[model samples]
Target: MIRNKKEYKQYLKRDRLALEIYNDGIINKLKNLFFPNPIWTFQKRMRKLEYYTNCKNYGLYKLYIYYLKYRYRKISIKLNFSIPINVFGPGLSIVHYGTIVINFTSRVGANCRMHACVNIGASGGEVQGPQLGDNVYIAPGAKIYGNISIPNNTAIGANAVVNKSFSEENTIIAGIPAKVIGKVDIKKIIKYV
Candidate 1:
C-alpha cells in the first residue's frame, strides 16, 4: 500500500520492472499511448487509489478518490480481477490478465509473481486468508486459501490446491493439498525482485 509519494513512486517503479517495462522514453510513451496495456493501466489506477485513500479525505481530493475507485473497479471487472487495495506489496506481477481473485484479508509480501486463474482467499467462512512471504511465485490455476503462511522464496505449481502452511523456504509446492516437491532459487524465478 502506498501511504505517501515516495512509497507510491517506489511501488510504480518496482511494478514497471516486474512487468518488464524498462524504457519510459518518448518512443515508449507513444507506443503505450497507441497500444495501451490494460494490466499496467489497472495497476497504476490501483496504486493511485491506495495513495489517495491514505491521504486527507476532503475537498477535491475526496471526489478524485471516488473517481479513482470507480475507474479501478471498472478496469478490474474488465480484466476479470477481484483484487482489493493494500492486499499486495510492491513489485506485484500479474503474469496474465485472467480470473484472479484475492481476498481482502489476505496479505502478500513484496515481489509476488502470480499467473492467471489464481485464487487466494479464506476458506470455511474464516476472516483470515493466506499470508504469503516475499518473492513468492504462484503458477496458473493455483488455489491457496485458509489461514496459511507460505514461507519466503516459495513457488507454487500450476493447478495446485494449498490449504496448509509450509514452513520451509526456497522450495516448490505442488499437487492437491500442496506438498513441497523440490527446492527452488527464487531469484531465478522472480528476476526483477
Candidate 2:
C-alpha cells in the first residue's frame, strides 16, 4: 500500500529492520548483489512491485513491473509461499521459508512477524479473510481463517485453529478453536515494531 516515494522508503526501512539487516552501505549492497538471501531478495522485489503498481505515471516502467512480478512469482513458488501483494503492511517479517498461504483478501497490519506453516484464509468459499491488527505475532503451524478480526498486539500460538474473533487485545490465543490463553507483551516478541 505504498502511495508515494516517501512512504515507499519508509516501508523499505521498516522491512529491513524487521529482517534485521541494518547496514545499507556500498559494501553491503555489493555483497547482497552477489550473494543475496532469497527471502530478502523476494521481499525487496515485492516492495518494488507494490510501489510501482500503486504509482500513477509509470508508463515507461511497465516492463520492469512485469519483470518484478515474474521474479516474485518464481521466488514465491520456490519458497512455497502463496502471499499476495498489498496484503501485508510495513514491517512484515517472514521468519522462515516454508508453506505459508494467505488469502488475497486478507489484510495484515504493520509489524507482523509470522513463522512457517501459517495459513490465513477463508473457511470455505468466502472471499473475505481475517483482518489482523498491528504488532501481531503468528507462530508456526497456526491456521487462522474465516471473516474474523484479531486485535492489536496479539500473539497466536503454534498449531492454533482460529475461527472466531477475539474481543481483547495484547492477549495470546491458542487452542483447537482459539481462545485467549494469556496476556502477551508484544514488545518481547516483535523487536523492530
Candidate 3:
C-alpha cells in the first residue's frame, strides 16, 4: 500500500508507465491531466484512493477515500472490470474496458495490455491462477486460467483459451487451449527498460 506523499508519487509514476504515456517529469505528468483515457483514469483514481484509505489513519483521508470509492465504483460498474488493485504491476494498460475480469490471486507483470472481455483466473484445482509476464498483450475475449506461467513479450490472440504455460518468450499464442501460432517481433513491441 502507498504510505505517504512519496509513495503516492511512486504510484503515479507506475500508473503513467502502465498507461504508456510520457512521465519523464512533473511537466509531463501535469500535461497528462488534460488528455486522459477514461478507463485508465478510473482505474488510476481507484487505486490511489485505495492506497490512501489503507495507508493513512486520519479522518479526512478516510472520508476522502470513502467519497472516491463511491465514484470509482460507478465507473468500475460501467467498465465491467472487477480487478483487485494489488494484483497488477506498474504499466497495466486496459486498452478497452468492457467485461475485463482478473482473479484476486493472479499476478500480472509490468506493462501488460489487456483488451476487452479478457479473463485471467483460476480453474478449480489451482487457487493461485495464472501468472502473466511483463509486456504481455491479451486480446479481446481471451480466457487464461490454471496455474500457468505466460512468458514475457507474448501476445494471446482474441477468443483464445489458455490453460497451460508457455516456456518461450516473444510468441503469439491463439486458439482453444492456446499454442504458439506465430512469433512476435520483440524489438517492435518493447523497449529495453
Candidate 4:
C-alpha cells in the first residue's frame, strides 16, 4: 500500500512533536548536565526519530532514512552501527533508542520484532547470541546476550534474556537469567496497522 504525501507529513509532524516532548523533558536535560555537546544531541535526536520512523510505514521511513544517510554520511553510518533498528522485521516498533546492538552472527526470523534499548549480542566473549525464530517479539530495554536458540512463536518480555535453547514454539521468555514464562499464539504476533 502506498502512503500518501499528506499522510507522510502528518506522520513526520506527529513523530517530531513526540520526540521534542521526550527530548525536552528527559534526554536534553540529562545530556546537558552530563555530556554537554552538539554531536551527542544530534545522535540522540536522530535515534529517537529513527525509532518512530521505523514503526511507521517501511517505504516512507526508508526514503526518509535514505535522505538523512545522504545528508550526513558519517553520522548515518555510525548511527546504523551503534543502533540496530530493523534487526528482526520491517514492522518492528522502535521508540527511544539507546546503545542497542544486534550481533552480525545471529539470525532473526520473519514476523519477529523488538523495541528500544535492546542488545542482542554475544555471550562469554566467545559463543554468539541466539538465532531468533519467527513471530518472536521483544520489548523495550531488553537484553538478550548469550549462546541460545529461540524458537518460533515466542515473546521475550521487556528487559528479559533467553540464555537457553527452546526447540519448541509458542513460549514467553522473561527475566534476568531468562526462562520460559508462558505460551503464546503465533498469529497474535503479526498485525500491521
Which is the leading candidate under TM-score?
Answer: 1
Please report, as a residue range, the 10-residue window in candidate 4 with the lowest summed lDDT: 84-93
Ranking by TM-score: 1, 2, 3, 4
Best by lDDT: 1
Q: Kindly report which residue pairs in candidate 1 clash with one another.
A: none
Against the reference, the lDDT scores of all candidates come to 0.93, 0.91, 0.79, 0.58
Prediction-by-prediction clash tally = 0, 0, 1, 0
The candidate, 1 or 4, that scores higher on TM-score is: 1
Q: Which ten residues in a row are the worst by lDDT in model 2?
A: 56-65
* Candidates sorted by lDDT, best first: 1, 2, 3, 4
Q: Write the per-residue lDDT of candidate 4 for residues 97-183, one digit (tens) a residue.
A: 344567756767654456666788788775566688766777876777677778877878888866667776788788977887788
**What C-alpha lDDT, on a 0 to 100 scale, does residue 49 get in candidate 4?**
48
lDDT of 1 by residue, 1-193 (tens): 6778999999998998898875679998888888877899999998888888886467889999889999999999999999999988999999899999999999999999999999999999799999999999999999999999999999999999999999999999999989999999999999986
TM-score per candidate, chains pooled: 0.96, 0.93, 0.79, 0.54
Please give the RMSD of candidate 4 to the true structure: 9.4
For candidate 3, the per-residue lDDT at 2 reads 57
Judging by TM-score, tell me the better candidate of 2 and 3: 2
User: In model 4, which regions exceed 4 Å deviation?
Assistant: 1-96
